[model samples]
Target: MVDRYVAAVDQGTTSTRCILFDHAGRLAAVAQREHRQHLPRPGWVEHDAQEILRNVLRVVGEAVQDVGAGPGQVVALGIANQRETTVLWDPRTGQPYGHAVVWQDLRTEARVEELAADGGRDRFRDVCGLPLTTYFAGPRIAWLLDATPGLRDAAAAGHVLFGTVDSWLVWNLTGGPDGGVHVTDVTNASRTMLMDLAGRHWSPALCEAMGVPMQILPEIRSSAEVYGLTGGPVAEVLPGVPVAAALGDQQAALFGQTCFAPGEAKCTYGTGSFVLINTGATPVTAEHGTLPTVAYQIGDEPAAYALEGAIAVTGSLVQWFRDGLGMIATAPDIEGLALSVPDNGGCYIVPAFSGLFAPHWRPDARGVVVGLTSFVTRAHLARAVLEATAWQTRDVVDAMDADSGLRLTSLRVDGGMTSNNLLMQTVADVLGVPVVRPMVSETVSLGAAYAAGLAVGWWPDLEGLRRNWHRAGEWLPHADPAAVARGHEDWTRAVQHSFGWSREPSSHDGGAPSAQPGR
Candidate 1:
């Protein structure tokens, strides 16, 4: 059943999207649905795992139906979900115990502080390419077990399944009421603190340290391997379709954008912006606390490793301007309004609304805006917000280069935010490298397409995806070094002003994580 098309279900932070690609790597159809984000308390974020699963089913069905394809026509399914969004579910019934604790949720900040205070925060860079923080799944899962009553019982009964969204959906889709496969791809597993980077399996030491049991975990597998066919109730849409790939959104983007060579990088501008540098076969253990994780795994490529840089707030900040403050009518309107001002006009925003990530793992860091003057208008604030995203990413790229030794010459940019030409050009000017935008901004979906195609023989391997890749636009270095330097200096000072402040309880006792403390 080699239909000329591959389907990708990209379950992203703000939306669930499905994209269909023909045999030649051309996009045939796309379906997107925006779901709700529940913020019950400040500094907390959540999504309904069941609702997300529903969206994935609905969108994929519509995409295939619009393309006039059936189960036999759609050869394989690849899933790339928002990484680090932790889900704890009843393995037997496929029901989430509570809302999916979003990657952005800071409810675990106190837990991270508890670990750090107990000396567990010391040199976490060894096995898990991350520190003790709320960003990863370990703390969130612990919070659920300790805080959610039924969870501990479920875990002890061996019925609780812990996973990022990829594992959750895969289990539900292929994991049936009778018996569905419970597995997670390596790329997504790397983000959880449980997996050992070198061994590429759940680490006993890590599980013990994080107060989690090994029994409830899923068997970790590679990104491109066929977990199973989509044979559950959702199969009502595309019956008997092979689910070939499951990757974290960032790794999927890296693969989808053809960043195969070492040092190749891509920046995804979603709810939170992510910058990942492909370090190739060998894992680059971050000397400076930049996340080191698996990029992706294919047939026998060993596990391609990567260095990750995360900006906890990117597109979400734009949402703040649109929804919270009512600055702009829509998200896209931000680029034009920000372009109205040449600069931040002495206003700088550090969106540590939860806590800052990457290079710096401070859970006490808080969002700050410095140098707000009487002359500051919505446009200046808008420009500052856009520039803030660029600045944070620039710091991440710098840290990535330092740690990986891959002199990043350019960055492939995707996600919802890259549509802003002003932001892309500004990111280029600040980083002093070309920022490339691809023909398909939905790199997650495209990466999923590549994976599903390869597994089912609709497309070749990574090289085949590379050959089919093409660029739509590129933002070259557009700022003088001196000007960028001065702007950065001002940004650095404002950053220092925002350090040690947090949206956490007083136990953590500092601001939420600060900016990447000056390289």
Candidate 2:
């Protein structure tokens, strides 16, 4: 008998990856390719949507080929993508109007500010469960309409379509212009700021507020269900496999971690770090700057909600150290260089590269490296880089605790960055919680596979998935309390310095920007 497998395409901010998994949830084969990140302006970030689609198709073919599996043996394809990366395309020609506005891009800051001024931020809180920030897709799409000529008119006329990365990949995979299903999962739709949290559908009111026509929105569906079959160029490789599941990457990580019960939480350290704590069926309006989002919805089951704290830069900070500073030849080299120093040497590297996100929401903020002195070496900066990742995780975990009232004694961690022992230990030390890395660190992809596999009856149920999860390693907090406090104090001071750097005097009334009105 031939062994059946599920393929998961995880399209992330920095790269695209495909992983094949067997029934046991073991990774059979994997392929990845990094793409260009177009930083056209100080606060603008873009990606070629077509390039991402090409990378996705290539990696999927490579992974399946490496595993010696035919398309028939592949039960289904699951998609987990970087959330909130907006792409607008013409359905007729299957070409994007322009580059995708990345989630980290702050190009929508002024637009978000305009909406916030009109009481748009808090007004939709009850419906969408998100604030007006550059982090969500609504503002970015709105900005695209105003910035891109003829695009808005086309969208209004139903000639153009809008989707986050997951929707884009799924559209092309199914058939693109040739009868491809245009849809987004509930989890992805929740981040768009146009979906009603309780109703689980597009809100015409919010659409009017953002000036986005409802005609261009994708159909909202559950996280696990057959959206369509592979077609077009994707059919050349994955011919008829059903697209069984689609999830925002972080939510996929949560499911991949088997955090099925309320209060169970996980933090995925990828291009950015997201800490999501399951809140069960009821959406908890966050009071601590955390965003309320859909976790996942399995077949006819009620949608699960999560209180999320998102940090826009984590692993990418290491990337900058490699590419920008040339401190390390590769990403992995940073771990060794960071360990060379006993500490950060009192330095704090706050990488607000696209401006601060989550808990702060300061789009005016810029990257700042504080406490730099003549005595500081490259090793100290490297250590600071790793420390920043830990501190940022602590910031979200702290807010998650405050909002959910669930004290996190341990964190279920996944993603590429979790492989760094030094970074993992620092995370444990800073958060004062045990950090557990799963045996299969590709939980993001596995989560996608789990959803698809479950849909096709590849796995019996959630209990089967629970048994598949096993911890590979663990880290416990060993730092002294005083040291942690001192480090955090200095980190807070450094973050303060980063704010108000790019904002016009009028934006802040010639004073420091006020805390975003509500959590």
Candidate 3:
């Protein structure tokens, strides 16, 4: 019998990757390419949609050829993408209006503040399960329509279309500009702040409030289904293969980690860190600042819900240490440097580079390194950098406990940062729970593949996929509880110093002060 495989496209913040997985959920082949990040102005981040599309095609072709897989052997394709990255494009040419506004972009911060002034940030929480913030797509869409000349009128008239990265990839893969399917999965839609939590559809009230036209939005669909088949440019690689699934990267990690039951949780550490717990069928209202979101939906069955805590900067902080400060040659070197020191030496770093997310939701906060003294060395700073990510994870875990009234017993972890043994130990010590990693560290891609395979009947069911998962490593808390508590207290103090560093200008104000460019 011929071997069959499921392919997944992981379009992340930094790069685009294609991976082929075998029946055992092990990676058969992989290919990746980095796209350029465009920073046109201060607080603005963009990506060329055309470049991303081209990269996706290149990687897909490369991955398939790498394993020498036959044409029909690659059975299905799934997309796991960075959510809330807004793309507006012309349907006629299938060309983007401009660069895509990344989730980390703060260009919409002023508009978000304006909207929140009326009813506070949580005004939309009851309906959409999201707070008013620049992290979502609604405010970004509104800003694009207003800033671009004649865009509002065009969008309102249905001349332009709006989508997150998943929709963009799906539309292009199916058949861009020639009967391409324009739709978004519930997981991605839930991050836009324009979808009703209960109805699982676009909310009219949110459209009007965000100044977005209902016509421009994509049709919301389930996470696992055949949206369309590969056609157009994508046909060159995997012709007629079903595009079976679409999921936000973090949710993909959750699914990949096999966190199918309620109370099961996973944390993915990448450009950012996201902690999501499966909360069963019903959406849980988060009182502690975590956001309720759709985990996944299969066919016509009810959607599974999750509570997510998003931390804006985790692995990116390491990137800054390597690139910005030239402190180390590469990202992995931080672990070696940090190990040279016994501890942080009373130092702490709050990486609020693009302002904080989750729990605090403070866009005014800036990155701060506190407790700096003559005794602190570069090694101590490296340790502090790693500790920052651990402390942020602890904050979210605490919030999750408060909202659900259940303590997390263990955490399933993945992403590039998990390769650092010291970092994993730090996370376990800080959270007072065991940190576990699966044999397949690429849970984001594996999750996408699992959904795709299930849709095409390539896999039996969720239980079959769960059986494929195997434990790779585990870290247990060894630090003194009293010492950890004191460190957390000091970390909280350092976080407070980061707040109120940047003030949002009011509409009545004549002008705001000029700001420096961000990383």
Candidate 4:
């Protein structure tokens, strides 16, 4: 008998990857390709949707071939994408109007401020469970509609279609411009600021406020269901496989980590770091800066809610260090450079490169490296870079505790950055809890595969998926409490220096002039 597998495509900030998972939740094979990041202007980031889709096809084919599996041997395909990367396309031609606005792009910052001017950022918090931040799809869509001539009119007439990356992939995969299914999962829709949290449908008032047309929206579906099948261009690789699930990459990580119960939490440290705590059936209001979001929804089941603390700079900070500064030869080299120093040498780096997120949603803030002195060396700066991510996670954990009213005892961690032992230990030390990595580190793809498999009855249930989780490594808190408190206080002081540094209008163009040295 041939072994069956579930395939998942993880459309990330900087790359697209396809992974195959066996029934026991073990990774069978994987293929990935990085797409170009277009930064036309300061504080702007865009991606060619066409390039991403092509890479998706290539990676999918490569992953399947790597496993020596035929299309029939693959049970289902799922998608986990970088949420809020907005794409608007002409359904007639299956062509995007422009590049997809990345979640990290702050080009919509002015629009966000204008919307929040009257009602403040929490104006639509009750309706959408999201603040008016540049990190969502709504403002980006609005900006595109306004910036592009006749786009609003086209959208109203149903000539244009709006979706996050998941909807885009599913549409094209099923059969773009050839009777493709246009739909978005509840998890991805929840991040759009156009969906009603309780109702689990598009909020009419939000669509009007964001200048988005209801006609352009996709049919909102559950995270796990047979939405469509690979029929069009996708047929060349995954022909006729059930497209079973879709999720925001962070939410996918939560599901992938098997945090199925209330108060259970996971943090994915990727391009950005997101800490999500399962709040169960009820959507927890954002009282403490954490965004309430749909974790995942099975077929017809009530949507599971999570409180998320989104940090905009974690792994990307490392990328900037490598590419922007040429400080290290590679991303992983920073770990060894950091270990060369016993400590941060009284330095702290608050990586608010595109402003801070979570606990402090200060868009005006910029990255800052403080406590710098002549005594500090390049090695110390590397240590400070790693510590910045740990401190940010600590901030989110604190906020999650307040919002959910549940203390995080231990955190299930995943993503590329988790492999750094120093960073993992720093996270455990900062949070005073055990930081644990699962045997399978690619939880985003795994979660998508798990949901897909569950939908197709390949996996028994959540209990079985939970049993597949095995610990690969663990880091425990080892720092002195008093010393840790002092360090945190200093870090907080450094964070304060980042705020109010970019208050002027043109300052939003990119990082503050003062932040240039740090970057």
Candidate 5:
């Protein structure tokens, strides 16, 4: 019997999650599995693409089975994925040439340096709406082609395909090694640094400049449209279910937060934290460190654009406290440890683990812990860890305000970290704006489900999605104005100590060429 349920596959940097949403936009069942993050060397990160594929299949089956729903009950499937992670696979065998290069990986730093030498960073910003940074997939894809043996020739011959996580899953879901559809939504394509922002297609000049073959690029489609039906192992759980929507994780959260109108904003705190403000219809070229991207595109409506502030580290700071420092047993223990200390105790931590992103695109920066004295304890360090997350949000929020000319009075926030009352209140205090959390914290997956449901007539239009949103709670600013100023002042000083720490002795600048844009 036909039913009105949508399945969303939220493929993130650290885990794969599958959520089933009922007609009213409530979660019926959910399942998630964390994958291994391979650090072959310092400043490098990777994931086994094939393992992610297996985990995705596992979670989808588990979520669907939890609610005792058959394939007929699941009307469609949508995808929301960690953007800019480059994956290259063979079309003939459906096997990745190597482990997927994560967005946090710095393996392509030298390549970006070369691009910066030729022209200081904003070389392709006009056409592609991105800068010459390792944060994008273009350089990573180029590095994969150069580092992997014979991959370039194979790409040139069209034997290989290149895509972010979404394309990899969509191809495998449709029917890997057979005739699966190879496509990605506009939101994902916008991050590749190879797609034309205005044209909404691959830019030939930028592609050639980045040394990527155009033949391997996937077809770009609207965020809310049926790309193909599920096949292969995915078909076993929901055969013939239409895979209707695909969006980058940040954009998915924006959609899920119901930030439909212009100037509406949201910050998603996950492995990384991102601040995106919606700029309706026409794209705004960013002069600040912010990058302009497509929020989402419906069937016939003009594409909505966004100005994004991408922070390289947030939740990962907590992970380091747990795993690297051995300060806590689990991820949640940091909050308790942090609460033991009233303040940061004159210490600050700049988690430039893979280098700082947004506002300060200093790729040469490394993680730094400043103002440490004999009096400091693990509790103080823990407080600094949580404080780092809040300060980083302020960095992006300030940049967003400058680029968009709209000051945010309140922020709609979601993700795993929103559960921490201390972090939420700190964010409010740091930004001087109310931090609002939605009743449904799983906005990432819900956004994908909403897009897919809209495509297949499960939800008629935007009004239906707006009706599904409701606030769960809020955090108002409580910190004294003087304290806030002093905290931000110390944070600024600590961040300065982090810059140029990772570069060679001779390089005073952040490893980029001395030439600035227009020089």
Candidate 6:
């Protein structure tokens, strides 16, 4: 690879992004486009798969131009994406059957309950390292097959193909219908509930249970591997440039945050918040409700495991405050607005905007604000929103610690929400551990760069990657532990009240609730 630059695609739920990072891991430029969010029914969300592809191309071209770097300087291209967004399309024409079933879509709650009632959910989770829910791809794939006409037959006849965003992009970039490599990284595949956690292959039992054809699935590959070359319309930028690495965005962020050692964890605050603890090369099965996931897989090496806590809301609540309610003029203004009030004023906000996840595992919960009084102003409401995220994060941390038997020395945080000083401060106070902020907030892409750079010798190894990690700041708790403890109790109470609240979509049909956006 002659070039020192890498083009990293970080596609998310609300937007598609492309960023350029040099070999030294410095940010060069970024291009992003917010696409349409379709809510065909309450609690259900979808995105056009083809529009996502279009946004990717536009953003990639723009980012390259911004840095005066194009495909030629892009030594390698790496992909990191929102895991569990299931895509199904015509193999012959490369056209999607309909919108992509977003991770936030809640259309399969009743179906999940049906599986659980049948006694198959428990057995599958034991083998797959994931629970039976709409949060994973297997269920979404099943939903698409059962809801869409001819999809089942098409999949069976090998006329349709299934993939997460990584597989979709690879197929489009490498010649789409003409023929692109069909592959998914182990990280993304892990969220599908179809891949064996230990063997890392599509499990026959899981597929049969979900009623999906194995032929439609992509071959799972290691996180860091040269998948193939670009061959489609966008090939002019850098034809035959190797696609070196691929990872689920959260896993990429974990690597990018330099959490290479066991027990090291990071929480990425975005539309939703996910906390992942790296437990290198050993599947640390959690007896306590946390999930065991593959952090990353390299070559034939043993897979790294993680204990994950999935929260539905984080920054989006703040977005709602600004856009939906007009509580604040802008998102960044939330920090000051929240800080304007000394506390939540005895109020607790349970942001189960879609539903609650992990520890509680309740699909019936909805967003609620408890302990409200006339004295509570918008500032207090703002503060409650920020505090709620911290409290929810602590819940995950506590569960992870209980399950893994590892006390966290500090919690590493990244993503757009981490930029808020007040939120970070509150998070530190609540977690009772120092919150370490990295110099590069875009750890998602950096993780992709780390894996891809290591693949082609741009990086010598994990040690070199850690040595180059740049930490920006650290925040520690300065408040009374007792007060924080009381605040946590209040938050839990608010969570309970959030349940059976009105106006939130519970399920697609009548099963376990779909995992919606947490904010």
Off by over 4 Å in 3: 319-330, 372-377, 503-519
Candidate 2 Cα misplacement greater than 4 A, ranges: 36-42, 146-153, 316-355, 364-384, 482-519
**Alpha-carbon lDDT, every model:** 0.82, 0.87, 0.89, 0.88, 0.88, 0.83
lDDT of 1 at 196: 86
The reply for model 5, stretches above 4 Å from the true place, is 1-3, 38-44, 148-150, 319-347, 366-382, 503-519
What digit string (tens of lDDT, one per residue) describes model 1 on residues 1-519?
455578899898889989988887788999999899999998788999989988988898888888788657888889999888988887677788889998877788777776778655543557876666666888788888999867787789887888899888888888555578888999888888888888898899888888988888888988887788887777887787888999988789899998988989998887777788989888886766477889998855688899987777888889898999999998989988988877788899988775667656555767898998899999999999899899998888888889988898899988878878998999999999899998877787889889878887777677878878788998999688999999999988887777677544444332125122110
Tens digit of per-residue lDDT, candidate 5, span 1-519: 454579999998889999999988899899999999999998788999999999999999999989888758999999999888999999999999989998877788778878777766777888888777777899899899999899999888889999999999999999988888999999999998899998899999988988998999999999999988888888998899999999998899999998998888999887777889997887888876788999999876789999988777888889889999899999998888889889989999999885677777776778999999998999999999999989989988888888887778889999788888899999999999899999889999999999999999989999889999998989999899899999999999999989787655332232222111100
TM-score of 3: 0.91
TM-score of 4: 0.91
Tell me the tens digit of each residue's lDDT in model 3 across 384-478: 99999999999998988888766798999998889999999999999999999999999999999999998999998999999999999999999
1 or 6: which has the higher TM-score? 6
Error of 3 at 233 (Å): 2.0
Clash pairs (backbone) in predicted model 3? none
| Highest lDDT scorer | 3
**Candidate closer to the true structure by lDDT (higher is better), 1 or 4:** 4
Reference-based lDDT, residue 89, model 2:
93
> What is the Å distance of residue 132 in model 4 from its true position?
1.1
For model 2, how does the per-residue alpha-carbon lDDT over 1-519 read when each residue is reduced to its tens digit?
Answer: 897899999998889999999888999999999999999998688999999998998999899889788758999999999888899999999999989998767777677778778764675788998776666899788889889888777877788899999889889899999998999999999999999998899999999998888888999999988889999987888889999999998899999999998888898787777788998898887877788999999988899999888788888899899999888999999989888889988889999885676677675888999998998999999999999989888888887888887788788998789989999999999989899989998888999999999888888899999999999999999999999999999998999999878854435322112222110
Error in Å for residue 210 of model 1: 2.1
